[model samples]
Target chain A: MMGSLSGRYAIVGVGTSRFGKLQGVSTMGFTLEAAKQAIEDAGLSRDQVDGVLVMMPAIMGEQHGWAARVAAYLGVEPTFSATMDLGGATACGSVQTAMAAIDAGYCHTVLCCFATQNWPQGVAMQLFGSEFQVPYGDVGAICLMAHIKRRQQYDYGYPDELYGQIAVTWRQHAQLNPEAQMRKPMSLDDYMRSRWVAEPLRLFDCCPNTDGGGACIVTSAERARDLAKPVVRILGAGQSHSSEIIHPRGAEQRSLGGTKAATMAFGMAGLTPSDLDVAQIYDAFTPRVVHDLVAYGICASEEVPEFVTRGNLTFAGRLPSNTAGGLLSEGHLSGFGHIREGVRQIRGECGDRQVADAQVCLVTGYGGAPHEAPPTVSYSALILAR
Target chain B: MFAIEKPLPRANEDTAPYWAAAHKGELRLQRCDDCGHVRFPPSALCPRCLSQHHEWVKLSGRATVFSWIVVHQSQHPAFNGDTPYNVTIVELEEGPRMHTHIVDCPNDQIRIGMPVEVVFDRVNDEVTLPKFRPAKSK
Candidate 1:
């Protein structure tokens, strides 16, 4: 359909540093740890990685020249080295970039890596909001999302518990993930009683700010078969960025612009939503999970409340989602963790949370709310196949 | 007792006139002279027509609450004492929207599409911010 690059490259290996509060490690330290693990997981030496793309160093207070520095630290001297800044979308953003580079013969193997220090001194709020937003009290992502949730409630009478259901489901998924940061079992009661971060948005409704890093290696599909791990080809990838300005008065202001990207990905892969064996979606906030699911056409817009109500989000359910507990519980590596989990699912390595007979996985990254008032401008989606 | 050091907006050339009008108790927006399209968060050129020519026009700050969020917790130091305050998206009558607070109305009574009008509140010595309150019936 579109000038297709389907099945051009595959994700050979994925890695993550311990996700919780790793107090003493610097950003570079975490990046190096994840990169080393990824290289080993791919069964390739450090010298074999000729391309490196560092994503969002600013989230961890790291300085500029990140790719070159990471390259130097790993002692690889990659032929292609740069940074990709797409806010929370950087994970899938990096995968799409690596796929294109490999197809063009720019580099053989590319390592995409990222690390963040878990909302150190409100860094997450500061990184996304602006002077205009702050002065007027559009403080954090919580408030921004709360506004959208309230709008949806106004339009559709969606109950407040709908978001709680998402939080509850992800917490269940987290219970099975040893690497997840917030694995404590939560009931609807816990979700209901949680303190309000923003009105209509309780504490549990927001993702825990996590300190960690995640990395994945991408190379040509042909080379991936020869590597150590089972191959997971990146079948299709698409990204779209719309309005940076948040139109406060517009209709349905929650538009993340992800539909464009998701549609393109489905077209490029020649696949439909029904083909997805599992979905690893970005959940920076719980409402985002609902919004993205609708955007991806996995469920009808009006059916979201009933859809999530059916408990179909668990690993054993009709539509397994965020099997790694997502940023809400899996720890926030931006969206990098989502990509890593997609690879794991395709490889059937998720021991406790593995979906049965999984073959195709859909992963998405949505972020870049430039001002607290705007809809998310950046969206990326990738289809990974075993 | 508590004090709030409200964050002041830094106005540049693109936004200086808008802020200046707010200081004078008028809500003004930039209208493209060539295209007749109004704009907010003032910019150098008309987004639709790409016309650099524009005029600053004042509008009746009458608006309705399009949507709102009650902030129970804030990361900013200035708002720590003001928990449970509302940040509203008000659609102005002239067809622009602004992020402003609704005053003189209880949190429970605020509703979408409720009419409101602007009231200037001085935040600092040099800056005056525009806030809104429930409008009386005609």
Candidate 2:
């Protein structure tokens, strides 16, 4: 079924609202702006959008029927519409959901979007594991990711310098991206000096809080060829979720569902990790890049520290990654910015940061159950080809 | 000013027994009668065998540090006074890992595979949290 769906759908257009702090915009306001821009980018009328999928940020508080609300606000009456919440995985998951919907003939030309205004409310409080974790001060993604990084250190002998290297490289890419938030040049010395948010995770290891939104239009590959921008084909899409929580005896603490999802995606696309020209890894924290690198079969687990240190993620390297700075330097639009960058990279639209002759771009979405109640239980992967 | 400031675990039907045992200075978990599987955070059915029949069994209060983190930053206002505390995941002898704090040990001294034993701390009238300390012997 997955194999048959490959190369059938494509992301024709992508757009985003302001990348950094915008004082006056509401969450829905950003969503509308991104959606409108995506419609314009595709050279399609707003009335032609018949399907809508939206992800409302948890930090902004939950609202019922957000997709319906977005559809109503955008003045589109669609045969298919729904809201999804898979934590950080929602953006890529939205694209996968739209592909499935289109394959099922439920609707065509789906607009998938997500935006958050994480101000005043501050960082999202750990809500799921409140009974087990809150009293112990095991709150927030920083602490959860710290636990994973610390375990990785114990199991794989990964050094803090390896994580810092990832931070430094992504910031370098951010400097080239005009839309990136933390564009200031960062050095390894600067990364080492940054304050620690958690013992194993420093301040620079985390993504910043920002108010932003991003949207992309998904339709048949044939339809995308008739659109305004270059056609970035969705060659493969795969998603995997686990019921395992962190406290269980057999819970997987070191890695996530990326391996299973990536396997399915690669299988559907009939490609291997060697075919990827560039990647947009979900870097809610730095170690996620390491996890995804191994999970996607890009390199052996033991080779990750060395692979990253060798400048493999730099623009001049074999496989450039997070070219738009990822969530680490791109400002957090969940993983939407990663998707947007993936599309742009495939289109050869990334001016200075573009990977030379980029063809296959891999974008991954990770994170669910914020505090590792089942750390990284949800994962989605998309294999895009030009 | 004397009120407890930290969040407390609220016991529902499946979890009340575990808390009751903790209040009595014992660590009890649900053990499946059919498959002999023990579970935490109390559930109705066994995750391994899907068996509904179970019993509350007291453990030896022994565990080993599976992983840990020293929180240099506080996420909640109540824990601001306790900045730089250690939150560790300890694997119980009965095979369930739990999220807890390690007492009587410096944050820097905690290591994976270090032996520890549970010690209950009664925070108030209704709750007693199970914390760990360095064990006298393996």
Candidate 3:
């Protein structure tokens, strides 16, 4: 149902540092490492870098990001620069914009970067906490999902351990990922023992606040085809937003929106979920795995827990998902690591967990409304087939 | 006028009636004419059918404790005094859910499917945000 563009652009190089608390490291420094590594990996020099696109969550309440600071450090002021203002979501769009610029001849070599120090802001710091917390009840990140998780348990007769397996399995996947933040392996017993952040959502169900950076280089496919070693082509890229605010109260928000954004993104990819060899979805919470899958039509509505139990999401299974431990385990640098893992799965670098002959992969970006059922559900979908 | 006024979280055009009525101490929601579906975060258009037809209707002010969380801390500068608050998503009798705080009950005692009734707390003279309390009195 989807077709590819005829040689628009390709990713020539990719770079990333370990995802964790990078206290001693400045975001600029992290961004620089990824940039240099990407340039070197692309077999291109700093001089060859003509354009730069950066995605970093705002630090210190300041609206700007690391693009200009990075360009200054690289000593090669770029001809084009943009700081993705959206939280962690810019990672996906940053790469998409680079490919577009390279394709449109806006620049020859485009470097995309993202760096973050999310935990320092206090994992407790989130906009929804301010906008929605009404002097009591569920507040912070877990409040938004608690209703649904609890409802799934009661209304649908699901088990309490439903969440345990998800949190445990993903962290298990992270154990294999050297750069993953939560490296300690977890068991269902350990998961259940962990105190609840909100009812039904344990502390382990959340994504970690990590400091890290990842960069990818996009250039003309002509240059890509001539590159040394293996290069993963940017087969397709798509992005969308669901009005940056929650629908007004009494807006039929229950019809389950934010899914529309996924529809537009997957359409842009010209591919369906069935075509994906692996997917790195932005799972800030566990149910989000269910949300993204059903929204994208990868699985039937309400089929998430069953699918997980059947093991379709396993590394050895049909739909290898979150092999880089996902946001639940690997830590969230705004979904950049998800992209890095997407690139890896396509390159077949995942080792023991690698899907055999995996050709195409999908990665999503989530940034949207704070109080809605799925706050910040913005997404970017990519199709990569080697 | 000289004092910093506490902002009363009022619903605007999307939720103006709900807030407007809440000003008069009535809980309200907008019903969609197209899909016959009730919604929260009031909108002039139906999210399901995308039809620009809706009507403001007063609610039963009745709901169930479909799900909730006991907030251990408050991040908002406005809510620093509130700790261990219960942020609840009550499934209203009309069918959709509303994110509100549950007052007048011990935090530990919050149970799923518990019956709850609306309670309005006046932040000031103009706004009174809707919260809930245990329908059964202590």
Candidate 4:
């Protein structure tokens, strides 16, 4: 946790369901598994929960209906229920909301859940026209990044090998996580050689469509002291929105780093890049992590490929990032996996790959693409501390 | 000889030059007088310095196919007839990546960083789309 959010809220319990193609299981099944596990981890009954927050990118579900359904299934109707519909940008926002509610005495115990099953074809969420992309239904991030890469390569000579390095780094971390999706070790050779999906980005450079669920039970700091596990407090939070188009008005000024969101959260948490013990930057694409690291001022923009190439983000490196394998390796539940990793890092339960004494974590989420410039739509960031 | 069923990006103050350039078979970009940063899909203000002072410099018609997608489906009826068409996003060497179509290139040989050059295709009296072909052949 950053010093700013040092004592705001503590995460007493966290849980994740297996991430893969569960063709027969309903979304409710996955949600219940994660919720039950989280409640068990917290040693709390469903009856004790006072609030519920449903986390999702886009309008996958309407009106927090899914949260109410999950609560009903769990046999514990939370006194308060809300949904974080900020696209993939709400990963950290969802967690922060529950924390804020807990702090403000809106709810004593809050249960947050996110389950994503929509795959390959995507969901039915419409901020714009689904018909616009119907001709080529695959017009989301792949095209978004492809456009950016095309421009970057046209001028900067950004090599394809840079994308490979990002894949290899996250897979290296995933190899250590038993629950990760792409646990198999990936190499630069394999990455470069993989079948191309778009012009600049290969299949491996993009995250796979995986089905999964994640949940966490949040409680007051004082109540957390009585729990069996250590409490990870919420330190800071921030978020920002961009125009709907691919390149917004001032795109050249903004990279996909999502600086506005990250800074807002960091400032609120009273922390800087150096204060973090670990980072779980939002990564729907391999390039996203690189851009976010620079945009968040974790390092210089031009030095990103070099930094990643130096193994600084590897499991054993001095500066470890995406220790949970990220969306690339651990499976992207949109951004749910991002939040779960942050909680795990703060919990000190990440086993051999865990950053030693990781007390502060920076987690970010991204939604939409560069409408005017490079990155568009909503984003949020949070600093979690133990 | 067609109709656009979906909404086009409609010419705006920032994008009018690009459309006008395509109309003339000339690829033009805005170079910011403030910082000398050249960009494509023209804009009112410079992205690098936000300076409004600039000029519309026509491109040399020389660029590389930075990357491309062989779009298997066409979302717009304007493109429905051209199923399995290629959408090319090329690096202008001039510092802008313009989204266009690729012509006169075999799909099998369209590798990353493949050299290519720009060409203009007049769809109707009102629209002229910029496209690319193999640099060697052009």
Q: What is the C-alpha lDDT of each candidate?
A: 0.82, 0.86, 0.69, 0.71
True-vs-predicted CA distance for residue B99, candidate 3, Å: 2.4
Q: Could you give candidate 2's fraction of true interface contacts? A: 0.83
By descending DockQ, how would the candidates be arranged? 2, 1, 3, 4
The best candidate by TM-score is 2
Model 2 spans with C-alpha error above 4 angstroms:
A120-128, A243-256, A372-376, B1-4
Q: Write the per-residue lDDT of candidate 1 for residues A1-386, one digit (tens) a residue.
A: 34467887899888987778776677777888888888889999888999999886655555678788899999988888788878788889888998888777889999999887654553443334554567777776676778767777787788878989898998999899888899999999999999988777788989887777889999998898899989998887889887523454256445547788998898889899989999998898887888788889988779988889888787666789999898898888888788888888888899999888889999999767645433446889999998
Q: B1-138 in candidate 2: lDDT tens per residue?
A: 664478788888988998899999999999999999988658888878899999999999999998898888787677888988998988899988888999999889999999999999999999999999999865
Best by the lDDT measure: 2
Error of 4 at A211 (Å): 1.2
Which ten-residue region of model 1 chain A has the weakest summed lDDT?
A119-128
DockQ of 4: 0.11
| Model 2: per-residue Cα lDDT at residue B9 | 88
How large is the C-alpha RMSD of every model relative to the true structure?
Answer: 2.6, 2.2, 5.2, 6.6
For candidate 3, lDDT tens digit of each residue in A47-138? 88888888754543454546777787888778778877555467777777777666566788888887776544433543433223333433
DockQ of 1: 0.61
Q: How many steric overlaps are in each model, in order? A: 1, 1, 21, 26
lDDT of 4: 0.71
Error of 3 at A229 (Å): 4.1
Question: Which candidate would rank higher by DockQ, 2 or 3?
Answer: 2
Report the TM-score of chain B alone for all candidates.
0.92, 0.95, 0.86, 0.84
